[model samples]
Target: WSSSLGGVRLINAYGPTETVITATCYDVPRDETLPDRFRGVPIGTANANRLLYVLDRHLNPLPPGLPGELCIGGENLAMGYHKRPDEEKKVFVPDPFRPQGRLYRTGDKVRMHGNGLIEFLGRVDQQVKIRGFRIEPGEVENILAGHPHLETALVAVKTDAHGEKQLVGYFRPRAGSRPEISEIRAFMQKQLPPYMIPAAFIELDTIPLLPGGKVNRRALPVPEDLRGQLSAEYVAPRTETEEELAAIVSSVLRIEKVGVYDNFFELGGHSMLGTQVMSQIQEKFGVEVPLRVLFENPTVDGIAAAITEALTQSIDEEELAGLLGDVTDLNDDDLNALLNDE
Candidate 1:
């Protein structure tokens, strides 16, 4: 029951009382892990007399790697919620395996990994599938908040008249800062999987808070006119580095005539492809730069300037060394070698 502080990973757990403290527990590791960020470790295995089944809406067992509602059955099932038959009906249902025994409808959507460990994807209510891919908004929001300049982030999915889902991100800049939209999108590109990246970003002064002081997600303003404000007509890059940056954007965005002021992510670039563009740029220019810098200046012109500035700094160091005699203090080995050469 310990509270989490900075650098602490929070793992919220749930299990019915009849199952004893908890029949199962999940351990979410600190930020970075090998394969995926959302994958968690199971604290215990299914013991005898108890059964855990992940099922679809039809109560049929789901195949592995697929997400479905979790149903808990066996001897540890609760008698039923007291004094409320309707409430009891909501959670307690007849088990398919036992034929007559009640099963607890946990309402949690989970996917069983190969090792028998379940990956919790949030409640069925919050679970959303976009573009035929299941998406957990909380997972995307968590990745965005890890950025140094991002104070807060919120992910929302809206369906169009055609019922096509579109992911949107709302964020507030940290104190003493206003970062470029390109930068944030680029940062997200590295942190999330392809489908998890938001389609658009909206800057907010503050996220509406509910009566309980939690995020008032329902009250979030729609992004109908927000796009026109964040990005106006494209601004062309002014420097040689900006030209190079524009080239990268042109390739990824498929727009030959991109302005230096145009945002990379705004023009169809996402986190997954953003990494590709970054890798290409690094290989082309031979410089190691921070991912956070993209958030600071997300346009081609901005990236070019950053690259040019870095290159200039390197050149300045070399020029300074040449101007001031040899940079080396002249170790005995070097001095003797120099004398021998003379």
Candidate 2:
């Protein structure tokens, strides 16, 4: 767009109202061609007389590429908010670098590049802690939007039925292209860690937008069930052990059904939930499955096999054979009844 404006220099300016408008400005290069994975344009250097500091929670400066809160100090800084002293005290803090000077905490997460340009990561308020990892939804949204089949992508934290927070991806497919949930999951898996991958991908024809053109997060529909959005196909339990394990997983994750090959973490299972699963496994299977085992195996079939191995080690071959025979002879109702009895 800047290239089309023959002689005009397009500058991207960033600032909050508290900073008296523009604090930092970036000169957009006329011949710039954005890369496929471009996260965002740099906010550039501080304006004249203004100081930009990318600082950690302690107001200590962060090294390049390390994300932290953006704090502004120096000349252009506002005195304070009008009659909002309590709020002012929260955001406007005394500058450790400059005695008697105040820095406005922008509440914006950013990282400085080696070139001294600042890259806006996202708002600090938008960051969510999931599975003990601090994640910026914009990071996932940026990667998900890079998928060939997606037109746009948005990620938000939604609490699942298990009272656990889970990442849910909402996306609009490119014109005339319908992307499979499994394909989207695969695309994200390659670029993200297991915990970062969304538990569900919901297709949207158009992402709801507010009058001001921002995404209407409150209007986004909640997914009824996440099982259909998983990367794995629905593979029913083939054995009594698998059936029991699947039931436990389904109940814990609050999903309708869990396939034998379905991943536990992919279904929003975290370390905290893994402990609960281990407790249930010991109670129901009469064998101790460590929390690490669930993380390592992370599948109904794998956990069932682990349980079988644990049980086998505790008993003789003849006893194991008899137990297997007894389980194989039971129907679904009888098995459920037996498990309930246990």
Candidate 3:
């Protein structure tokens, strides 16, 4: 490794904000890969006097080789984030292993090794933000892996040429089995939200792995198009409202094209993204649409009708307001005029 780096020493450091700075360092060897190289780099033992503890979600210390959050309790650890008492109290809890001592809960998922090293696993919270929506890719992968045709699955976030983040899934099939992308997509649609479904699927004979047995994600090839598994024929938007709504959903979902009659939920929309879609419609067309309206009318054609209805209601309300003329009471003649005008 030093030969590629022109003969320089490289050090890997690990710590949390609560620790003020780094608490451990690893001197990388040239040929032998570190025993604890996982999430990014190996977090070696605590330096000097600092103590590192691996504990489960309930703050119970786990035996070596079990995955848990790495908690730090030592002199080097700072009290907590300043002015973030609510957050501070959540992470900096009384040490379960040591009586009356403070332990900083590092959100990182890691497992202790028998060699006195810790390997990073991943974030305790696997939620990933893509196009303003916090998505859980693991949830999608779990659904994909559950398919009988699939052996294993890996999901990742990829950016298309349009600068939009899209979820892409890669999977390997069982021996003597070949699964269609459309079949996998139909399987995912049964339980997952539209946003969680991958925009593209790539089949692999075998997943590439690193020397450390981790997936070599960078080696995976990019899919050619955004039309992952939706087998519908191309249908253009018929109305101006349909065209506008399709554009919004396509951009949000990172798909190249969408149909006017396509179900928004079927196209990967969720509650939070539904709010965005509704907000944009209101801003663009000057009509406030309730969240339930979108749920009830999921298609572009359906929503366009709702928009027209809202506008007509607004016109009727305005006419009624004008006829009343801010008066406290309306006579029969005034009410009759308003009714006749309608």
lDDT of 3 by residue, 8-35 (tens): 8888888876787787888776766543
The TM-scores of all predictions, comma-separated, are 0.50, 0.82, 0.54
Worst lDDT run of 10 residues, candidate 1, spans 37-46
> Which of candidates 1 and 3 is the stronger one according to TM-score?
3
TM-score of 2: 0.82
For model 1, how does the per-residue alpha-carbon lDDT over 210-253 read when each residue is reduced to its tens digit?
88899887777655532443364767667667777778767765
**Which stretches of candidate 2 lie above 4 Å from their native place?**
2-9, 30-38, 130-134, 161-164, 316-342
Q: Candidate 3, which segments miss by more than 4 Å at Cα?
A: 1-95, 98-127, 132-136, 175-183, 189-195, 211-213, 247-256, 263-276, 295-297, 316-342
Cα lDDT, model 3, residue 75: 81
Lowest summed lDDT across 10 adjacent residues in model 3 is found at 32-41
RMSD of each: 14.0, 10.1, 12.8
Error of 2 at 110 (Å): 0.4
lDDT of 3: 0.77
